[model samples]
Target: MKYLLKGAGLALLLGTTAAYANDGLMAEIAKPEQWAIPTGDYANTRYSTLDQINRDNVKDLRVAWTFSTGVLRGHEGSPLVIGDIMYVHTPFPNNVMALDLNNDGKILWRYEPQQDPNVIAVMCCDTVNRGLSYADGMIILPQADTTVVALDAQTGEVKWSTKIGDPAIGETLTMATMPVKDKVMVGISGGEYGVRGRVTALNLADGSEAWKAYSTGPDDEMLVDPENTMVLGKPIGADSSLNSWEGDQWKIGGGSIWGWFSYDPDLNLMYYGTGNPSTWNPSQRPGDNKWSMTIMARDVDTGMAKWFYQMTPHDEWDYDGVNENILTNQEIDGVERKLLTHFDRNGLAYTMDRETGELLVAEKFDPAVNWTTGVDMDPNSETYGRPAVVAEYSTAQNGEDENTTGICPAALGTKDMQPAAYSPKTNTFYVPTNHVCMDYEPFRVAYTAGQPYVGATLSMYPAPDSHGGMGNFIAWDNVEGKIKWSLPEQFSVWSGALATAGDIVFYGTLEGYLKAIDADSGEELYKFKTPSGIIGNVMTYQHGGKQYIGILSGVGGWAGIGLAAGLTNPNEGLGAVGGYASLSDYTELGGQLTVFELPGEPAAN
Candidate 1:
């Protein structure tokens, strides 16, 4: 059961790493001059070592350039910059555009796929593409039409394309692909539509699918070597995932992998989380629903699962585990361990040993997380190895079908696809989060292909004592498992965060403001109003000898949908998941890429 990253795979990875070294890609990424990977680096820290745009001069930052995508939807991802070229992807029809960074952000080339128009209806949240990844001179994009395409990094021509999911049955692709070694890893989206989720690896050269492992089903389908799949130092045993479900529900059990991914080159394992089970009505499908609401560590080449840990067993609320798994090496209780930190949608934060799938620390990142009283990890304790569900919030299980009231953290849980940034310099994680709660009522839902499969009608509002705000930007200390500092916001912080070595952390607000705060003290330093609310990550790169920061501005995600569509149902607060109905008073809809630089710098080329 021992796995080694040897042979061609190792060589492919070494080639990438060496090429990265030769071209100084790693060094460039560290310099705040080039934003290489989507997650910044393989560690997925989203931390830049750039110091030029320090706190002292951040107020001098001004608009350098802007580009219009012309598609007014949620702009949920950041642009990828390689050398002098920057790549951007749009929603729905999924257009890929490359900008010449040296020529004042000129349009170099644009590739737009003729995707099925009907595909938009099946998307659970707002239509979002989480950005692209560049590897070995190719830009990898996961399209919403259930296909992954590799475009020529230089010319924007289609190199190779492979379909990974079936949109007809409610599967789509929104997460960005991760390029590891010679394989590009991608996952599907459709937990709400009852489509079984999966993660597949494609040969980076020709786009042929290498291997796929499902989030549900039998051990063979999941590539789960249960005898070797250690869950906290003990074997999970054969058919561990399959037996956890009732009947044949595992076929459509909904363990989607639609979030961010991280990797450890030395361990040769890719870490990703899976979404919740299908039919949010937990009573329909019983048992632990293993693999759903879980994180899995898998072999990069073969897609064999080494181990997994379920964050929520039989998720009653729609607490999807599809959050980013950030890889880092941190010390815990006096020993340095290869750690994977995840701020789950279930309102709990976990720090685990990525090498062995052992839980090291579990705590709440948000204080209002009341769905579960606590995550019990002590093996010998009576409430061992599961979340201690709070009876008041267990509406679905409490058999209150007529809209049970008062669920803290709402069905949105605590965070969404907007990922957190980890700064190695300050050893602090900057988390963008939601501070809303909900009232839920679950009804029976019959599955139908390409239709709304959700069984819940929930109304969300800002948590009580939340000071009338729906979001909080916080700095979390993972080693100590504590919140270092928090800044409350008028709306949910739907955008991703960027932490830099210069003691500044940047993020966008749902009200369309881009702000840079003191990374160590949580003091707002600089703020700029954009054309629309921001739902994208902040990426920084140096072009023409000037450091530049950029993010996409469009207000159409689940949090911003009410505002973008101009839905003003103040009393009900029903649509757009009922949480942000008041958003229209703050921002409107638009799609633009805004770039900023210091006032003195000659405009980027």
Candidate 2:
């Protein structure tokens, strides 16, 4: 079952300890002057240590520079700053631009890949590329056509290009590539198209296959040691996935990995969550649909699963578990634990022991979540760690063609792919959330390659009987499983959040305003309108002794699909268009990066 790389020099490459490469990357991340990775650091904290613009002076922040990607689609991830250069990416065609920071943001080189336009049809949501990765003088770009290309950082010359998946059969790549010690990891998209999802690792030197792990399949194909890989501290045994499905239906079972990934060098394990199962109709695929909506921890060297925990089994609401996993250390009940905190789309915030995969705390982060009463935490109960389903909101219980109404948080959940930020300064997590509800009807459908296999029709709107707002920005205390403060918004905060040592937190709205708030109190400090609505992540870096805050404004994620793709139907975008139809009234289509800084002279290096 060992999947070793094929090339001759791969032995030497694999011989290099992960600690050596991790140490080099860790040193780069230690420097506050550069954003070396997409999620700020491997923990996916999205936090910065810069304090050049403090809360007292943040009101005077102004635009220092702006650059357009010229694609005019949804931008989901932030740019990477390495030394004196910044790497920017675009959607669809997947263009990469390297800007010279020593100059006035002049473009040093650009790499554009020619992809088939038909690939756009298979994409479930808007055509968005999360971002890029840099390692060993190479810039890694995962294209929408399922190609992973490695470019020379300086000249933008193609070093190697590898095809990971086939777009003709409903496979694409949207998540940002992760390059570890000796491999570049990429995940496949298209859960709505009944695509069997997987994660593949390629040799960093020559792009040879290192190992591939499927989400649902035989234990050997999944790289899971049935008796060794623990789930909730219990072994899963054998055929855990095959036994859960009805016959060959598991072949197209969708458990996509199109989300954020985090790694712990000490454990040498990488963590990520899987998406929902295919054919949204719950009755179509019986049993628990094992491993579909689960959080997985795997060894980076061999693609072997160490542990897993299913957050929402046999999902009926399309609530994807593919959100980011934030790794941190905290004390709970007088015990210090290596914790992994995840705010799942199922409307629950989970805190677990990262080493042994033990569930610790599970609580509702949003007040409007009503699909389930809460997660069962009783250790002695047979339903331990499972959600207590409220039959009134169960689409499956209502049966096919019956509209199950008033489901809170909708299918988009409280939060989509837009990530949250953790600030050690306040010991809190700053989350951007959606306040919405939906009515869903499930039906039976036949599966077809490259065509959507979704069998659900839904309509979404703002949550009723509350603030009337569609979104909220809250400060969550994971240790206490409570929200300290919440700020309501007229629209969903579709952008990724950034926490700084300056006691400031930043997030963008679907109305194009990038607002800065007090990290501890959730008080608004400053706000500025960009060219378009923002669905991108916020980033910060220092160059020439000047700190700058940057965000991409394009407005085409699942939250802004009504305007991004010009869909006018209420059932489109999986009910997101109907929920956020008002987004077009505030902003239009555009793609640009707006960077901010305090008005002052640069300090000496």
Candidate 3:
């Protein structure tokens, strides 16, 4: 049953009781029939309720339709299905096309932006757009050249366009925007270029700046109330973020917010995680590097930091804490608790209380993770939840000219930008993971405006004592703190995971195969080869009483950055930074939307 709200009830449900400009328009996003947000819902679960073509019959699924995205460096986002029209976004020039689903997926209209071609060189990874957010009859797009545009949902007309970041300074916008009430929230990416990261809110009525919060800055700029902001049952002291850094380095300190956002309507709060510090050389800026590698909760309307917990204090290996924080209800100690589960790039999966920043369960999802022994979560312990570094693998501790060998789970961390999906039916997190390690050597580098300021040299390969495969797809049981089932892959599982009510989980591999597996047991049910590797998220929608699954296939993200940068191993240990050496040999890059459905015509509604 789809939840449809109207009038005051709709407004109340959205927590927009204070009356914003577009209260009614915002409530339409929660309807089950539409994929309003990039992560499928405000909680960023990526789980769909549609189940007409599930488990038992999923094996009968076949390709229903296919469309090509002309310009593709990396198609890293899923198509947005609203009513009978599906929205698709491509990379580089960032094209938006609407296809009428009821009429054989015909192109209704397409909008292409006049973006500056020079911006492509500044992008840290491949040129990719994370998709769009729909609200107030507009498809909100965050272009690669640091511009945000709102297009008419029906006619594809440009309603408003505003500049959010300056590409000349190495600040680019790649992540999707999150719109709530009258605000369309967007964040910046440029940690690799010494660009200070922040999340800005733009008015939906007109593309005007509403408020901005820097991830690493003074309390006022960060919108942090030192007396009120809580971190581990303690108030954050004055200049906590500032005092953590040395000198004025905090100005260029990198805490990029390039991941997914999740909101809690009842609490009227929004949640997001920040990326790594300015440069990979942690010795440059010391002291926990407050707010750099942290998960922060803030007021949706004003963007004030309520509580923040640093996941990787003084991060050394580029292990960004920018993974998705999935909101859901979980039973802990026989009590139903509102929980947030995050499978971090640091190789630790955390389950915490969403209402208050409290750690509940912290466990390692990957057995090959050797950077940290464990996360010490006892509040009374001096190292509460901090990663106990293995001295040999600590690049920061080793300093310049020193090389650290056999760093398991590599600099890519256990995961990358690819998201994991949660199933309420089974209470399991289907995680796509990278199982590789790297040898690192940190060297000092001078910062220039539009150039890479990274201070590390890295080469990745398969971890020791492991089957030479690069990745794994596993079902994680957060409550029990164990792996329910595991599936190994030859290449990194770079695509997002999708779980359905029909007990079917879907994900794509770097090998260009779209796969459907049993939700209860990790057994492969169906597989279809696509034109290219799959780097996009998987989503399901229903049209004309028939359920269909859609995903974008065009691999060229960080894992495939080797291909995009025209890099090949000149020597045995050089070339790509991460353990993505197998990407070129295993897969090639192209763009296409592959939609699947069970055989048979649509049933009458």
Candidate 4:
């Protein structure tokens, strides 16, 4: 019945939300009938009400076929298999392609936007696109230039393109993840240089700016300012954010929107996590910094602000609140209610009122750092460690490697590979995380659009016990606000998780092994290897009776740095971050799209 209701909601969404009803572009894309991407439909449930591939036979899974994508930079985008066709976007501009899933590795059509190669130089992350969004009959893509481009779903042709940012202004549009409609929400990156952050929604069909929201406001608008930025709670003159800097950091304040975005279509609302504040040094931006390190909920159509809850106030650990929010319903205190849950970078799992953005619970998901006693919502906002987390960062010239101060979750937790996916079968959300801490010291530097993120140095340390480590997969019950079960990984699992009807949860590890686990009890059921490492999104679909599982195997992503550095650590042997985790010790720069199905015959991709 819940599954049927979800389908009905998608069916209704197909016809309603006619605000951009021109060209029927969004109307014919098929009812929001399937879990097309990461958010699992327009709303980010992470839970699919379907259970075709239950626990019993999930162990029997095998490879179907492999499609080689010769060009590999960072494979983060999940393949969107719509009907018999699969649409995918690769790194850089104009790399979108449409492949036929009817036969293994068949190229139906490939469309490249052919934008200037210069744009690739501007991307903060390794030229990656999370995935393409489909609605009506068109596919929506955020190009390297921060422009939203619509592609014809069947032909893989561009329908329209709207520039979202000015690259010249140090503002670049590298949509880290796919955009969810209602909010058409997109986040900014370039945080290393103090670029201001924003997420905007445009009319889906016409690509017109519906509304725009900012992460950092004026001095009076600044929520957390160490300097006297405001006069009686209002904006005063002299923007100290500009004191040490050059370029737009003083203006935008580097609250990069580069996080996962999810939506709740039925409620006509969307949620997105915000990135860390600019210039890792806490003393610079002083106040709680408004929307940065926060989660925002807004109406999908009007793009009006609904509610926002800050995860970390005046965060100094470079911990961005940019993680996925799972929309689930659970009975709390005997009352069943709609709720949104997130395991934030602040080492906490939060359950909030989906419609009104109320923080019902903000429980520590990690015990490594207790920078704050707890969250308080009286007037409604976050209050950090009694006197605020001390970010005592000193200079190297003064002779120091940025003396480390222990901070929980290191620069990697709450949940990294898209964070905790929910499975309706067990009513649980599964997440992969890095359980570690770091002593981060600050260093001052000039702001450059395409340079490294300076201003704070990080010295990391492992957890004293096993509860937290470089990697963890935890099953959390939304109603309880607690961990149901957890399994540790050898390395940080950076791939987005997928829930299949196969009665299992599938996720890729950094070193290339895609593992399946019993959704009920944290039992390892199956695993396989890809070309390199799997740091992207893993998805599953069924066509022609055979169910299929697919994801990328690339090692150039964030995890590769440590994996590479670990390789040179003679003390650690040849085993790298994800080494020996079922993946062979090999460096295959080329990434291929591999799918697994029942041995012998190939399934429709």
Candidate 5:
């Protein structure tokens, strides 16, 4: 049942009692009738328990209501449904609207921030805000200009606003704020602008600076306890990050954490991955570029590293390690283990022991991936936990100015910022993936402040000799490290996915089709084309005793950048244009929310 708070109870829930607030938010998250957090819950599962619109009836779903954000660009995140109110956010200027579900989606209030337009120039991809976070009766927004603001959920009044990064130096914010305990955590963007990346925590109560941790730098600055922080279950001695880079290159290292965040409350650890290092021309700065392409498990309260796992050391494919980590528990080898499953940009699906940072399963989610032979799984091998790089596709080994062709997954990886969903009922993950490959050539480049520092040029196309399509939506069995079933799409599945207890999985496509499929069979159940292409995540919630599904339809992200930004060059948009150029022929630019539900009277709760 939906838990509606009001008056003194609502006040108590939003009070300064951190424990009570956490408990209250956790309670709300458990309801399944509300989208309290962007990732649905702290685990970032994106799974809903509400099954009112099951596979048997999902075909009858129709549009119940729609709201336009009045802004055009790539919409990367989903709206949050808290109780009777729906909070919607937009890109670039980052306007937020609060809608009352009881009154035909009436606007309760709107909060629009005036951000500098120049900030868009420094953003690597399209200017996309990943949506908002709600906590302690406040809606948290991480603006593109690096300012984080908290607004009153009821009145839409600014509670507190603070600038965390300097846009003049190429630091910006594109991720949604993750509120855990009494802290609101946010990460920086601009990996393509030679900006050093970091994640910062702000006081949830007052927006005051709490703690900051750099992704690449000295151990002290990174808040890494060399003696205590374990990597592959072994202590990483002092200067682990410093010794991995040449000279002071780590200062401009690009380990941006612009993706999603997941937390394990019991372990008190927040999990997130870092992006690739600066200067895609890998030969410029050597060593493993420690921590740049690593998965980090840090104490949520102190922002100190507890464990680390580097996925792609010295990344040469621009394969960012910043994909969302889905935290789940699965039976592996007759033992119930806490598993962290990630569909990495490098075309590998990883299932690791979330508690100890132990590698459990690593396999290619896409057959087209050929950059690595496979991850060395032997514990005794020197390359244990590392990908056995294929010399034929290693851009670094080919050196600068030489094109590395037929690299599967491209710089966009198998998946970009689009998030995958986990269904506990099926023990399967529904992933939105790209089936594209690239020809990458690295070249020397000089970094100028707030200017693009990308040192590589790439052109992408569909994975040859395959489906000839650009994307796939697949059901993955993490326990087996394999795809249970796969569904091909004409373009990359750039939108996030949602799995429901109803045995239905939903994801959007670059052609604006919001599709529902059978969770077990991967059979397409229903599809509705929205006003524009969908790069936004799919979300669900129940209101007035009725279940509803929602998605933001816009056409600008890395994949849709060619159309969204009016760029016609095939090489533009960081090689995304070449692969997704046809997207414009299918859908145009739009910024609106299309909500779907069954046509009938309110169902009994």
Candidate 6:
């Protein structure tokens, strides 16, 4: 009763305090100075309020500074620039480096950890570094071994390292973007293998335990109350087979929070999405897994869940909900409400109530999705594909293939490069999409740690619809929760999002181009190719009467690396890669951080 009263009182205070800033995103869209707040403000829109380089003068934008990460493998880490400093991470051994964003990219300090070379053998995705975190004068780096390490933001010194879960127990993962707040919001990997899945949080100040929430369980350790009030977690068990398979697969369930997480301060909620299950065979872990493939709402301080709405229940497809959950409010069905949205790898455009976790609207965000007709609320709907146990490919006649139905959006969805960011001012969401498909052929396998990490093997084929290249920049509508406008490109969008007050949405392409698009309409405003491939998130900010935009230039990961070889000759849309994985030829490039600003001497250019 005491917790409830306190929660209600805090809610009432926030409800009344945000009245003036209630301009949809304004209430949450962070300021440029608060670049410390990664994902552009708390809502994680990746949008900036500074307008130093608006559309009319963005043409004058030129290079301001560039920093290189030396280990050139996969450059997916989104740089975090807070106050006067910027933090970056690299793939091998996962090192953390801090530089002065205000300087000409001068190295302020470097903190390298004695990481294990063996951890490399465990990562399911590319050996890449997504990013780190900064809050309370400290930097939080979520390492490959499922450990969250804190560093002094001013001086690159280790503050504390909290090894939350074991990567050996299926925890090897990366940021692909960086960590936000000191919220040690970490999750497990090994979904391809038979590892358990879950996400947890720890205090950054002294590495104390804050909260933990698992991916699968009705008898979950965490329980939440709607209306933004109470949250407590305790292990609970319930039938998950109705959503996953026909039997008791939850016994070894696999839905992880391995993608990205966002926040909404006004609502005081932290949002994170979970990944898909292992085996790709639905029969293994049957039923709609609880937090997996769902965007969950939890209180930042206590780690209590407020509400959760599953996007894909019992997702037979390899559609892990490992995308960024961006926060933005919109008017829908003639009603104005707060919005929680994401571009799902499941090929779905998901929008829900940020506070209650109710499905406000869900649609097919992709052009080629054949998994299911659409989102069905019923538990017994046979529309949800069966497990791979019934597959004809299996030697056993009764065995089958449930996931990987050869949809247009393969494991890569309508949007895979990163999460689509929105600009409330323009009322549009900026997103990246790949035009590709895969014919999934599932085979039984096992998880023996150093052995083949996945329990099942899948052979991928090409899509019939995509005419070559990957990526289409779309200007989406938050109001209607639909595509406002779109333009196709040859390369996949591997970088993060950048929305500026200057009426431009900045992002990068796999073919090494940092481009800008008109925020209101889907039109290319400017494009510049970097040294090699571009797979980093782009950010914009200002210091001494100048505006600058920046992103990393290197390509790795399935989003960029796999496409490199298949892109040599160029067939249709910008050399869409077929199936080439290693990028030894470009490793020497050592990913450069290119910063652009208005022409000097005469500032305006």
Q: Which pairs clash inside model 1?
A: 33-542
lDDT (CA) per prediction: 0.82, 0.88, 0.84, 0.61, 0.89, 0.61
Q: Give candidate 2 regions above 4 Å deviation.
A: 1-20, 603-605
- Model 4 clash count equals 37
Counting clashing residue pairs in each candidate, in order, gives 1, 0, 1, 37, 1, 45
The global Cα lDDT (0 to 1) of model 1 is: 0.82
Give me candidate 6's TM-score against the actual structure: 0.83
Question: TM-score for every candidate vs. truth?
Answer: 0.94, 0.96, 0.95, 0.82, 0.96, 0.83
Over 537-565, each residue of candidate 2 has an lDDT whose tens digit, in order, gives 99999988899999999989888888889
* Ten-residue stretch with the least lDDT total in model 1: 2-11
RMSD of each: 4.7, 5.9, 4.7, 6.6, 5.6, 7.0
Candidate 2's displacement at residue 255, Å, is 0.2
Winning model by lDDT = 5
Better model by TM-score: candidate 5 vs candidate 6 = 5
Per-residue alpha-carbon lDDT of model 3 for 51-119, expressed as tens digits?
Answer: 787889999999989999887568897989888999999988999999998788899999989888999
Q: Write the per-residue lDDT of candidate 4 for residues 193-252, one digit (tens) a residue.
A: 567777776766677777676666643333324333232122323443333333444464
Candidate 4 — which residues are off by over 4 angstroms? 1-35, 176-183, 218-250, 376-402, 448-453, 467-469, 561-588, 600-605
lDDT of 5: 0.89
Per-residue lDDT tens digits for candidate 1, residues 1-605, read 11121111001122345443324334434445778788887777887767789899898889988999979878888998888888988876789899987787788999989888888878877788888888778888889988888888889888998998888999989998888777888999988889889999899889998999998888888998878887767888988877888888888889998889887766888999999898888878888898899999999988988888999988988889989988877655456567888999988898887999878678899998888888787866655658899877785566637666778787777998799998876778899999988887887888887776777777888989767889999999776678999999998899999988778999999888999999889999999999988998998987778788999999877777665545556422233435776677777888899999898855443
